[model samples]
Target: MYQLYYSPRNASAAVHWLLHDLNVPYELIRVDRKQQQQKSAEYLKLNPSGRIPTLLIDDQPLSETAAILITLCERHPEQAKMPALVSPDRSKFWQWMMYLTNTLQNELMVYFYPHTTDSNGIEAIKQAQVVRLAEILTLIDRELSHHTYLVGDTLTACDFFLFLLGYWCLALPQPLTEYPNLTRFMRLMAKHPSITAVNDIEQFDLDCDIFTFID
Candidate 1:
């Protein structure tokens, strides 16, 4: 069995969705952000960075959502079947995942938590991140026009990763539904039973209208 430490509506959500998608028995250990439980000594012992979505596989612990998802996919090949070990799409899968995590998510965090990056120029940094976010969204929007999923037709952990990012994009002044291709892809993703289960567990009120806005 796997053990997952999650905080509602955090970066850990992607991992949570993946855990459900895998359909393997896993225990969710909630780290209450309100009480600073993630930073607690016990939690820090699991993750030195004191981050979230730490999965305990066997007796060992795994951190970083991207790495964890890749590991899980490799472990449970019967589930996703997309991130194949030996294929051209395998490389492309890594490409899109890294772009979402390292590029888009990196900028989004800076924007969402500006004080961590620039204490004095918070507003300037945040506004700059907004522009960067839009540009990244456009690239993803275009990619979706070519393929249904990030790498290929079948669903992969990358979809869950992108779903969490796109879901959070709701906080932006511009609605994600504006990106027709991306919204179309998102609508397809929103119907997945694994995602439905995760939202019910986390009580995430993801706006279903985002689905309704498109076809």
Candidate 2:
């Protein structure tokens, strides 16, 4: 059995959704971020970064959403939640995954915590960052304009990655309605059975009130 250390409304939702999609037996161990439980020595031993969504598989621990998603896809190829390495679409598949994990996610973190790093010319830098994020969102909107999912027609890890990003964006005062395709994509993603399972998890409701954007 796999043990997943997670907080309800965080990026952990990605892994939670993936596990539900796989229907793989697993244990959900709640890590309360507000309580700073992730910083505990015992938890630190599992993930030095003290982040949520740490997966313990037979005592071996794994961290990071991209790595976890890839591992799950590989471990259970029968699930077909991700594209095959040799598949021609694999490059684009992995590109979108990394883009979400690295670029989109990093930018959003900056938006939320502008003081963490030197803002330099504070006002100017914030404006530039917002512009960059808007451009990225526009690109995603264009991509989804023609296809139902990030990769093509089917639900893949890429979709989950973007879905979580959209979820975060939705919580902000800024509405994603500006990006019509993205809004539609999120609505479509909300209907996935796997996603529904994640919402049904005990902690999801309390933690992900932002997801109510779908309703």
Candidate 3:
């Protein structure tokens, strides 16, 4: 069985959703970020970065959402609803996942807590970051216009990553009304039974506290 260490509302949720979709049995180990459980020495031994959503598969620990999702796809190729490692579409899948993780996720973090990095000039940085994030969202909105999922017809890890990013926007101080396609995609993702079932788990909440803007 896979052992997942994560905080609700973190990238861990994406892994949780994927596990549910694959019908894989796993143990959910909650790392209470509010209580600084992620920084505890015991957790650090598992993941020095102290990040949530670390998956322990057969005693091997894996971090990063993209990496974990790819690992899952590799382990359970038969249950793939997403692109497989050897598929021609794998490149596209990797592109979208990295974009969501590196670009969208990073910008959202900066937008939430500008002061965390720029102690003296937070407002200016926040404004600039927000504009850049809005531009990125606009591009994503256009991309979703012609495709139901990020890569192809069936839902993939790419779509789950994008969905998590879009969900963050919903709780942001800024509204997502400007991105119509993104809004539509978010609505569709919410209706998936796998996603709903993950939410039903006692530890998972639809309104995740970790993603809420921290400013």
Candidate 4:
């Protein structure tokens, strides 16, 4: 069984959901972000970066959400959570995965933690980042209008990753629900057995569509 260290609604969420989607046996160890347990020396030993959702595969620690998702998919090819090694969609899979992680995910980090780099003008930084995020969202919304899935017609890890990021966007200025296609995507993904199971465990109110823009 894989061991996953996670905190509720953290970056670990995607990995947590994927583990269930893949129907793999796994153990969840809550890192208690509220109490700063992720930075604890004991936890740091397992993950030097002190991040959550570290998967213990063969008793080896693996970090990064995208890496974990790919590893799990590659390990359980029968589940078909990702593309075949030679499939044409393989490139598209990598493209969306990297865009989600390196581009969209990083933009969110800046929006949420602007003070990390611009303590003097945190709000200003966030205002600028929000514009960039909106552009990213619009691009994704347009893309979704044409493709049933993020990559090909079938469900893949990219969809799961997008769902995780969309969950974060629930608090954005322009609510995720405002994007018709993304809202459609999220609503559809929320009903998946794997997502539903994780929602119940995490106590997330995704089913109720708890998203509203506060002006």
Candidate 2 has its poorest 10 consecutive residues by lDDT at 202-211
Off by over 4 Å in 2: 116-126, 202-215
Ranking of all candidate structures by their TM-score, best first? 1, 4, 3, 2
lDDT score for residue 160 of model 1 = 89
> What is candidate 4's CA lDDT for residue 188?
78
Candidate 3 error regions (>4 Å): 85-87, 115-120, 202-215
Instruction: Output the worst ten-in-a-row residue range by lDDT, candidate 3.
Output: 206-215
Q: Model 3's lDDT to the true fold?
A: 0.80
Model 4 C-alpha lDDT per residue in residues 1-215, reported as the tens digit of each score? 99999887888888888899888799998888889998999999999998777999989999999999999989999998888988999988989999999999999998997765546788888889989999999989988998788986799999989988988887778877668888888877877788788786666676454432222
| Minimal lDDT window, size 10, model 1 | 206-215
Query: Cα RMSD for candidate 4?
Result: 2.9
Clashing pairs in 1: none
TM-score of each model, paired residue for residue: 0.94, 0.88, 0.89, 0.93
**Which candidate would rank higher by lDDT, 3 or 4?**
4
- What clash pairs does model 4 have? none
Alpha-carbon shift of residue 72 in model 2 (angstroms) = 0.4
Off by over 4 Å in 1: 116-120
Model 4, residue 197: distance off in Å is 1.6
Cα deviation of 118 in candidate 4 (Å)? 5.9
Query: Candidate 2: lDDT over CA atoms?
Result: 0.81
User: What would the per-residue lDDT of candidate 1 be over residues 1-215, giving only the tens digit for each residue?
Assistant: 99989988787888888878778898988999999998999999999988887999996989988888888888998885456676779888999888888998888888888865556798888788888899999999989889898788878889989988888887887888778888888888888888777786666665667865644
lDDT of each: 0.84, 0.81, 0.80, 0.85
The best candidate by lDDT is 4
